[model samples]
Target chain A: MSVTAIRETGHLPDLSRVPLVDEVGVEERSARFQTRSIKKESKVEALRMVLSMIDLTTLEGQDTPGKVQQLCQKAIHLHDAMPGLPHVAAVCVYPTMVGVAKKALGKNNIKVASVATAFPSGMAPRQIKLEETRIAVDEGADEIDMVISRGAFLQGDYGFVFDEIAAIREACGDAHLKVILETGELGTLDRVRRASVLAMHAGADFIKTSTGKIQPAATLPVTLVMLQAIRDYFYETGRMVGMKPAGGISSAKLAIHYLVMLRETLGAAWMTPAWYRFGASSLANDVLMQLRKQATGIYQSADYFSKD
Target chain B: MAGSTSRVPVEKTYKIYIDGKFPRTESGRFFPLEDSDGEVIANICRGSRKDFRNSVVAARKAFPGWSSASAYLRGQIIYRIAEMLEGRREQFIAELHLQGLSKRRAKKEVDATIDRLIYYAGWSDKYQQVFSAVNPVSSSHFNFSVMEATGVVSVLAPNESSLLGLVSNIVPAIVGGNTCVVLASEEMPLCAVSFAEVLHAADVPGGVVNILTGYREELTGQFASHMDVNAIIYCDSDTDVAKEIEISAADNIKRVVNRTNTDWAQEKSQNPYLIKETQETKTTWHPIGS
Candidate 1:
């Protein structure tokens, strides 16, 4: 577990050098992003972009193969009645259901993302976590969303958390790796920023906000801090990273606000699904409902939409 | 300070009520409700189609819990609303008078409104038993039918008898466990917003009864067309507007209840059948011994 073998150059940035988050500034800036009015055609475009950037996810203990298959179907055909709608970026599930999701999503160009590393709570042994990542990647997961060891991270064992993320990233092989900070457990915006930098340096292709298993899973201020970290990381290393804010964002209006924040913080270069994603279970239908309202000039009903 | 010069009277802008909160209309438009002498009494929210859409969303969100609430609890809450209205009796009479009703007629309408609420409150838990039936079927099954709330309802409160009419339309729907989004009389919307405060104070849950004041010409189509609203009850005698509502309601096959030309002040207006209007008959067939 030598620290020098983690990257190609074997060089990790100074952990203490990560900038401290200005709580007041971040809150004001994030709140300001919501005030920009996107109307008509621009709104419709933003809605479609939000749809394309979604990682249609179902990560419940009661998740069956049938449920996984149904979620994949939803990813493929999001409101078939509305023509010209974009399909989602991916379908996220547990490691055990990755194979089921992969088979169902066949050739639809929608990726199958699986959570590994003892998801939600990363309290397991490092070796077993690596094994889980390998298993999901072997089962045809296009992307791996692994949780960080919050227990160790909270205990000031930055090296241990960094090593675990680097090991998991290696086990993912060609599949992209998304590091989950589960910011709700991190407790502070400063810690969230520090963890974002550590994950990006440790070889995470993406830094996600939460595992969606905690209260206050995702919020504007936390997301703003992570986006700033990514921007700074890109400026220093000349390498781009992705972002995924999962859970608690269920409205079309709120999702549009996230888009506004992304555009303002990261600029147009990071607007596509490859650079950003939303890990949500109930967000797809809401976006569809809004689109239907836009099309017919009448508000929609959940009764008409298929329940996932 | 006690002997300070005379001050200007404070005027109020009556906003719409949605989900137990009073918010100005999203459209930011207002209409002046003038007295008989053509002097402006107050500015009322000119609620738009967007407001109706938002209220429908609130009503639909409230439907599941309200529809499943105990019938006894619903009855008690309706009774509580009557009590709150009685406490505010003078304020409502003054509002009715300000809207151009004669002083005596205003007092009468306010009292009748209170009694009407009590009448509906008494019928709340009993209507299901009165409306349900145990049918004798040809098969060996115990066939029984019961009344169930018809999800979200959209109401166009009568233009005339503003206070009494608004309460009459709202009470029956909610008594049956249905949530409603109601549009108050455009010409006389003062008491409707005031009555919303009574509902708010009485512990009628947010979204159970949302009150909006606006022009019917602009909002009737939206109220009827919303797919989330299960029924639409229009109280005006405008056949053209009613026909328009009926046509828009056909999109979702929504239940349309036409109470056109009904006088709310009469005793005939208070009946158990009004509660049945926004209710659905759900018949259950249980297997029994042959």
Candidate 2:
């Protein structure tokens, strides 16, 4: 067997016991999801669902308080002309801007999610990483999106990676911890599955695909592998872990494909924002544009939509 | 006949050009072109409104870069298209002949089309000079109005002359730095697709000119009513359809240019005024030194 079952330590499952991802099968299955014909009333409903599932995010070096506030406003009122639209699931930002986002999003019920733990790299020390996670949680972030140490995981240091995630989960206190695997850097589907299993065992409320910084962030095949891991974890532990495919999901059509994949893989129970989230900012406007097209029976332009 | 070797001919699958690529209509539908005898000559893509919608999106995406491009570069690119067309003159002549034109007429049309492109290429950089104005202002300020390309124009090529009419409508709009989505002649769409090939080989950017082949009745409404389209040029003389287009264009107050009943073959049809049709005049008021 190519995959040998690694020995289990404490509560962590044997790494090898996690099934090896059949790259071909996973890719073919993911491609099938894109072929589903979602049209008319159903398409409108799916667009609404995609809009509701987005974690309107802006994690940039040039990010300012003003930008974060504008994103929050966009999240709160996603197209005022289209009444009865659901607000986004959350507004994701850096740790420092979490407070600003939270204040701007106040009482609107939109969650504030912050990326912590030396995000995009996870290159910081364990103590500082946990401190950053704690500060974001203290700043009233409802969710803490932390990147797993890809370098450590790549070097076969599964124990260190697992422990670090466990510590951050502890530091998160009442907030949800979404573990970003940064699958682009993980290299292979096998490692992505393993990392997903590890994150789940280490207490991740959600397993996100990318940090929106990598070149091939949040692709369908990688996302399919992660969602399958979530499924297997659910069957084994009777716990539901959410899935988020961030980065590069800028079009509403692609977002609908993700929803189809989620429904078929995890059944209808995992169809809401509580179980599925799209960590995309540009995707909101696209969904709005599609909705307007559906309503007006004419093609839409981006000029009318608000900037993220 | 018995000694001659048999060779199979490869027929080209005619497809619509959108965003610089030859793609079958998203609707996956096609209409067969027939000769005067009613025999199937070839199959052309029966473009849908969705295809027009997609082309509008492409034209809108290409608008910013094409609109901001320098006039000199636009002129050079338009000239390059003419050069390419001249190089492929035999192919266009053959296509027009296959589409039921006399060989003599096809040659004449192709030659005239090449000349028309060169004419527009020269005007690309000179039209602003001819149309711009230096107005006398009451205040101590310099006021000058210059021509600016409208964002995206939707054109319905004349059914009478496929190649020449399509080129006449598209070159003027794009030469002035505007991108366009044009529906080719339903009866004679062969040259239009070949012309798209010429554009691809030329330095013209993707989405600068998208060519679709379909019935005008189905697409004319979409072409006129699309909010993203800045102006629409209808060349057919269907008064009722033109009325419908004019009424629908009011939704967005789109500039509708009626070129119906105009002979595209005439020398008087080609001019810089056609370029001005798709351009907006912007006046700048500069403050004088104190």
Candidate 3:
């Protein structure tokens, strides 16, 4: 496809060069109290709810292609068994296993996501990282997860990081790119907000937290900061960016609270999976267990699902 | 001849503490530490990067015991410092007054600083319980986790609340078992030096809490980018300065905590978990069976 034609036809907005407000409050109660109240869900509705917003990349043993495929199969099985199950937004795996997950999820519409840009560490060269992104997209991956070079961002080399992200976005072609800021390692909320702005401006479809490898992974404060970044980005540029809070999120109540925060902070426009997702592996079963308890009036152990 | 017969004793000025000893400036130069009213209160030695490096070396040497000290012991040490601070309330008040705080506000700030220390001290043992947990693994081995302090934290204390803000930021970090090297508030360095004295009196160890009074922009960049410093607390505003520090911190993936202008005082709980999160959780696993 011609570059001009691609640019003209792309549904993705030109978020490159968008400015973002980087400093905000960090109080948990302050963040929670800032949101408005909405109608509470009935227990039945809660039980019937499917939290499809999960990414399985950080699952301990699931780093290998075989493990990735097994995870896909399990997700497919869960989808079939629980008719009420919400289709998980995607099965995020490494680039090498994108085809494995894609084949396993055939016709299921479950996205095959791959982590690129030398994910986790993101210490690789820019050209190699961009090539990795292109390779992931070529491997039937529907979504590409890339990491910003924390070194560059921390060095005040924002331009270098911005250009690298822009290049990766071009390599992604039609595939969605979720830029992982690894917010836990970013330190302050201000930097997190700045990185979010840089990512969105450089054409990130969604901004994610953590590579799930850092000491401090995703926290509510950091997620709240990122969400506010998205809200402000939308307000300024008239373009909405998706938010995916990945890493260290494993509880049902916390997941619900995150959703509540999203709903209240960004309003109903961002409540859908298209705009918000939880990149987690262990969170789904907890959501399910909570849903089951809400339905049956008795809490069920996590053993209802396979421990493995 | 009659005038020469009589003499009065001269008051000795306090020296700047560097690497555990009071040191005169290498340049043999001193600046008149003045009150808000421009009255000279004392003479403070102007510190240099050499002094900073010396303090960092002292802090590095003390990290093993300080960073690995039991949370309970750390709490005890912090609370003792708080108690000692409370006893020296008059001194802090005087210093605060010298730094431009009104009498009532100085008293209040001193009280709050002590309370803040106690508050964080009380959290040393409990914060890990609150924030960390065991992962319910499908494995046979027992698994549990809690937050561990990152060693050798470097701090740039808030310029506004000189003593109280410096204490508020530094105490929580040490209470959570992190040794720190703080760049004291330039405008109000007396109280910080005094607080360091209080820590010494409270047996806070030689290098557990190192305080340096110097230029922020000049000294803080070195602290933030230092390969040895594990974390940085930027208590001052100046977004550009913070951005530079944060970007520099990325060199070692050092944690950075930038305190905004929000009223942290009105907030109910000053959980030590804020400091706790800046550290890593090292989860070690071994087969349970012998």
Candidate 4:
């Protein structure tokens, strides 16, 4: 027999015989435990947790360097005075303000994130987006959140969208690139998924749901679709992309539910701020309130933290 | 539930399907479609014959590397897609709800569709054993038959089952090594477009599976009669369309599969064998020299 025939008919390797980890037992038990957790999260804490994790951008329109510094200092004071402060993931700002956040967060280890890519509306040409991203990276922004060309993406110019992301990613170099899909305008969950995948494929370090500039931003369904895109990208490339549900995430309980969804759907690997972030400015106090309630079992008045 | 009557919003964009990327439609013409509620959704790019031709070119270009890829690797990619789908369940549910399915049914359908992908992903490497055999004819020569993936097949996914039927049909075809051109269900083309994102994530070779979302009746006949299509699968239950496609397929002796209202979920083996059956069998013989 010829070698080709021999190779074809040869005792095809017995793939089924390979010992697999007892996934049946693991899956069943995990499912059972997860179901209970899901119930607890869905019922007890989802709204509260989502409200707490805020992005904390532009506190009272402070454009001056000194004013931005004061804002960071105040944030630090809030962090210190409230022993039960809910852990806000990051303080997002323009590139110039990253240094102030970094200085204020010294030794605290809170992330210093910057928004790039012609913020609010991504109308600039590709080179301009790259330059803006480079400036953000130069400013010591730990993570760079950039917006996709809504015009391009909506125009069905996915190549332009993909190339834009890929170029911005190149400009980021070592800094993480968070590609925003701006799901509100994408208009459908299906479009969100498509955008999410496109971003991930083009080397997005994280996939964000919105720019917080449009109406109907940051719904759970949109976030869910983006997360799935990350998971699928990871499956295909063995690279786990992060998820950021920006725009309207204003509660600790809701943030926690997002975490719960991430944990249950993507497993433990995606639980940290590195993998998940909430972009909101007003959500911090609410998270603290709920955390305090969970801790001391007393409903603290909202004013207790507001006074600080 | 009262708000369920609200129409699912449609995207207003025109794009191309080239090398797994949904770029702007090459010819760049768009037509508007109305939702069940008769509200105009986004203007979908009306794909042209040139777009189809470009997609076929890309698919043909991508066929070699994709078909020759290791089955284990392919399985890994497909399994990753299942993981992604599971994570995005809420989105799928929401989209399906917008497509007019009840919330509970939508959730169930999305979940089942994801599971279906995992089922076929696991079978990427095993179908050859189940489908290929050596026949001992009473001659000095040895005859062995093996199934080779038909180069680039075209597909018409069912309109109703949107997500599940889309995956059910496409996964089997690609897993068995055939690259494809898929016409997304016209009524709910969003999921198919979204699935292209997942495929891109899995690093599926560009052109292995190309999707276009437009009116099926307008496009199906054109797709059916195309010369480049080596095989065509009509997942619709419309008998007349099926008959017409079967006849057109005879022009090129292209393989034709008319899928009925069968439940793909209940099938016994989620292997590539079913997909392989639609392809041509190549048998070779060699004499054992003395």
Candidate 5:
């Protein structure tokens, strides 16, 4: 007889055991969520909710302290001309800028999220990764966005990946840890689901889709698979893990669609910023524009808005 | 078998041209374009606020490249449009005839529109030379005032002279590097749609001249009120509706240009003044000795 289960069903975790997602089914379902008729009052309301859920991010290599300060100010006073608009949930920046962002934000309800551990590529040694996490946490980051070891994950070194996440979580202390799977590199939806489970089990407070540097990041199907994984994880552990579909989600319409997907897949409980977040840089301006349009009944211009 | 069977005639769907693609209105609402004899000619897409918004976006997106394009290149593009229109002469005239015009009158209109395009194409590179001037200033500086295209313009095409009036408004705006969203004449929209095809063939870049076939009453407020639109040109509209446009336009301080009761066939109609209306005058001063 041919030897099936060729790896001898060893200690290593096989992603084949993870629920096989029907690609077409997930796509069709994600598309259906987008088709929901959100207009006028409901649309304005959704825009407001989306504004509150944004993790206003600027993680470029060229990020300066001045830019971080400007971003923090924007998070606090988003469209002051409109009046009565809710600030974004957090200001996301590199670990080095977290202190500047936290200090600039000062006393505001907005949290500071910092990306650490050789972000966009989690390639450094585990000790250095943990040390980076400690620095960000010490610098007063309310949330820590860490990239996973894509090399390890792709090589099926699940234990190494899990252990690194747990170590980083321990270093995170009180700060919420957003484990970026960088699903754009993961290659498939099944891999995304498995990665989400591993991240959650290894102590991720949230599962993020990308590092905002890769192409085809945070696609609806990928986000849907990860959200489902979070849902199933919650079912088993009775603990909620947040979801942030970072990158390529720039439009107000797409943000609202994410909210719709969140509401339907995870229910109304996960609709808040506490459970759902959008890691975006330009999304805040678009939402603010939409809100002003709804208020004034006129399409807006980018010339009138401030760019951070 | 041939005598026993009757064939069903295939009809054309007159969709609005937006962003270089002929898609029906996002609203999915269409109104009938009927002939003077009350015959249903075609169901044209009734443009909604959403369509107007989408067109505005396209125009704004196209503005930078088209406006900054060298005057010589713009002249060539405008001339190319005329060339395309001349080639599609029979098509436009036939469309005009379909919209209730005799062959003689439709032929005249098509010829005039073609000539108008050529006239504007000639002025595209020369209008600035004629309009801009170097001023004698008190300061020890060389000062000059030149014309620049004012971003996106929303043109409400004339109710009558569907083809000629539509061409007249679009030519001057695009000649000056301003992109436009033109609302074609309601009852006689066939020629407008046909002209969009000419523009598409001419390689007049998409979004430079968006054509929509819909009632003015349904879209006037949106066209005037849209904050992104830099200007609104209402051709041959009534005082009350023009006043409403002027008022709605005030919210964004939009330039409301009135081209009412224009004799589009007149030689005087093709002039630099029309081109100057949609342009902003930039004054530059440089120290003479520096």
Candidate 6:
């Protein structure tokens, strides 16, 4: 249970010593982020930045190989009509679909991120979860997104959750590891902060907000607490951790709000796709519609955009 | 009797209604509404392009649930609108009179507006039956056509009559399951805002009907060109305005209807063709025995 066993996290503190989040302050802070106005050149620049930061996810139970390939194609050649647009940061999928996504996105700069640890409901045994990560890695995934066992964490078993994440990070090898807090299940902003610290200290390269399966996923307050956790982590260890808000962000305006929050909270250092991402499926189309609206001086339609 | 100050007159500021909320124009500008004597009665919101943009967002958000709702439910909602308007007939008449209409004509306009709502209510569930067809095919197939709502529609209400014109243009679009944003007459917007209250009480969902008070010249280009809007109902006369809408609408291949020639006061104002104007004919074929 020593810090040495938790990957290379040598300068980390135990969970009991990490500061607890103030719920009211986080709520008030999250509300204030939406009030700032981003327009004209700044708005166009933010829209383009948001387009590049997207993860372009498809995690349905009925996702077929054809569907994953189609999504990968969309990730590569988004709105060819609007030239000079940026490609999405990555293509996120379930462990079983990682091979299809990786093969279809051949030679492209976009990364393939696979969700493991029995995602959404992380209730599997430790051995099986490690094997799932190994398989996703063997299938050529560039990043591995592992979910923390909320049940164990909620029962005051922080050590178990920390060990499990470390084991998965070891299995990820050269691939980047993203730990999903699934903040919707954590109940309070305090627990969200605690869980975020635990994941980062256990060697998470990125901390994602949700599995996109639960309601109230990736809310602003939840994301703010996690971003603060990332900020505090960098202040101590001097190593930056990326962030991804996965669910309920389907519109261009809301996505821009998230970018604003990211810049204000974490500063300009983490603005790149390498440090921030949106794990979404429909968000790409909305951003494209807004881009087209800016280009043609008219409203755009889903009929004209490529169907995801 | 005790000496007292005379009662202060209560004047209402008519604002644009979008997403079921009464919000002032994002531009924060207003135009005065004058009585027959040219005295300022009140200042109505001069809705800007951003207001129209917000309304389109609301209409697009409301389009799916509305288009998928049962036809029987849509008919019931429109019927409820007629009931609500009937209760507010006097208020509408008084507002029309203040805007320079004669008492008799104001009453007639309110009456006609009520009848128009009921007319569309009846057709809400029956228009598909009358207009849809089972086509004869040359192959071993069963081919049939049905009317589908054309998503979000934008309407430029007629400037001639405040109450009847706004109701006539809006009822048909909602009856056919398409959500709409109507630009109320600049000269007479009181009845239009009051009608929004009637719609609010009638169980009609928000964003299904948004009324804006503004100059058509400023908003016409946006209404016709917005990519989210599926159709534009131009109910004004100026040939230049019509040309602008037609040209802007071509950017997205949006369906633009020129209903400016029709008189809203007559019996001919309420018809199924107005409903058809915002609906698409969707056809499906099935092999008889594959």
Shift of residue B148 alpha carbon in model 4, Å: 0.9
* Candidate 5 lDDT by residue in tens digits, A195-302: 988888887889999998999888889999999998987787787889999999999999999888888899999989998999999999989999999887788988
* Per-candidate interface DockQ score: 0.89, 0.75, 0.01, 0.01, 0.81, 0.73
Interface RMSD for each of the candidates = 0.6, 1.2, 22.8, 31.8, 0.6, 1.4
TM-score of 1: 0.97
lDDT by residue (B1-290, candidate 5, tens digit) is 36658677788778899999899999999888777788888889888888888899899989999999999999998889889988988988888898888999999999999999889889988889999999999988999999999999999999888999999999999999999999999878888888898899989899998999888898999899888899989975578898899999998788889998889999998888999999999999989874
Q: What TM-scores do the predictions have?
A: 0.97, 0.96, 0.48, 0.46, 0.95, 0.94
Q: Which ten residues in a row have the lowest lDDT in candidate 6 chain B?
A: B1-10
Per residue, candidate 4 scores C-alpha lDDT tens digits across B3-107 of 969878674353545677878666667777566798775577677665666676677778788788888988888888888888778877887777778999888
Specify the highest-TM-score model's number.
Answer: 1
**What C-alpha lDDT does candidate 6 achieve relative to the native structure?**
0.90
Flag the better candidate by TM-score, 1 or 5: 1
Colliding residue pairs in candidate 6 = A299-B227
Off by over 4 Å in 1: A1-10, B1-8
Candidate 2, which segments miss by more than 4 Å at Cα? A1-10, B1-4
Candidate 5, pairs of clashing residues:
none
4 against 6, candidate with superior lDDT:
6
For A1-308, candidate 2 gives per-residue lDDT tens digits of 11111111126678988898899999899999999999799999999999899999999999999999999999998999999999999999999999999999989999999999998898989999999998998999999999999998999889999888888887887788899999999999999999999998888889999999997899999999999999998888788889999999999999999999988999999999999999997999989999998999877768778886
Better of 2 and 3 by DockQ: 2
Q: RMSD per prediction, one decimal?
A: 2.2, 3.8, 19.2, 28.5, 5.0, 2.7
**Candidate 4 residue lDDT tens string, A1-308:** 24222212212122233223333543353344333334433534554334333456652344766766655655565546445444456678887777777887787666678888878788887778788888888878878889988887787777877777777877777777788888888876666777777777677778888888787888766666666667766775687788888877765546665676677678888866667778876666656655564554333334456522
Output the better candidate (2/4) by TM-score. Answer: 2
Candidate 1 lDDT over A107-160, as tens digits, reads: 999999999999889888988999999899999999999999988888888988
Q: Candidate 3: give its CA RMSD in angstroms.
A: 19.2
Model 5 bad stretches (over 4 Å): A1-14, B1-8, B288-290
Error of 1 at A75 (Å): 1.5
